[model samples]
Target: MSELPVLIYDGDCGFCTRSVRWAERLPVRMRILAWQEADLAAYRTTPERARHEVLWVAPSGRVFGGAAAVAELLRSARLPWPVVGWAMSAPVLRWVAERVYRWVADNRSRLPGATPACQLPPEQRPGHRHGS
Candidate 1:
């Protein structure tokens, strides 16, 4: 029930943690929750939905996903970066963002987390327990 915006990220990913720490330093006051720490049981955000992408919940109750989430993050940053958010929201800019997000998502498992070298197909099943 905190009134501030919320940034939801993967708590166990070191790279993601570093990014969140930078966002936490932004001038705008906000709230951050690692998916591992957030109690999402009551929310509509299903486990599958929660694990696939980053989430940004605005104080006004707007929820942004994927690229929009990134833009929301930029908007919350100090200044020049806020401009990046605004620009990112533009039609042409967002198209590119979408592609960027897709590429990242496709390789998210490799970013950092416990896992086999890469996620395997159902047939292969990366037997290791760690996965991004």
Candidate 2:
């Protein structure tokens, strides 16, 4: 709607929250909101989709998800970020980057700044072991 980019993320995920906060230091002028606090229908996203991945909505109404969203955010940032963004958008690199992003997201609870709440439920977590 507006001429500003919107970054939508999961409010309940401590790791996601921390990552968004860290993104504030970037030079991009954007609005950051938790999907829980926003009307996702306006962005063409469902609650389930928002809960599963970060989204980037451009001023031109383009929507990007997952690693692509990360690339768009970086592309809007200043200096070195744009370079990194370009690399991530490269054909071969984009494929690898997406996988890496998924891996990190799946293991986010074990990362720095993550809280227990950031951990996905056992059934949803990657490589989850059934019982002990």
Q: Pick the TM-score winner.
A: 2
- Which candidate comes out best when scored by lDDT? 2
What is the Cα root-mean-square deviation between model 1 and the actual structure?
4.8
Q: For residues 1-132, could you state the per-residue lDDT of candidate 1 as single tens digits?
A: 458878887655555566678777778677788765666553335435555677887877677877899898898887798999989889999999878886876675577542542354422432212332
* Candidate-wise lDDT, in order: 0.69, 0.84
lDDT of 2 at 32: 96
Candidates' TM-scores? 0.75, 0.87
Worst 10 residues of 1 by lDDT: 123-132
Worst 10-residue lDDT window, candidate 2: 123-132
lDDT of 1 at 120: 48
**Cα lDDT of model 2 overall?**
0.84
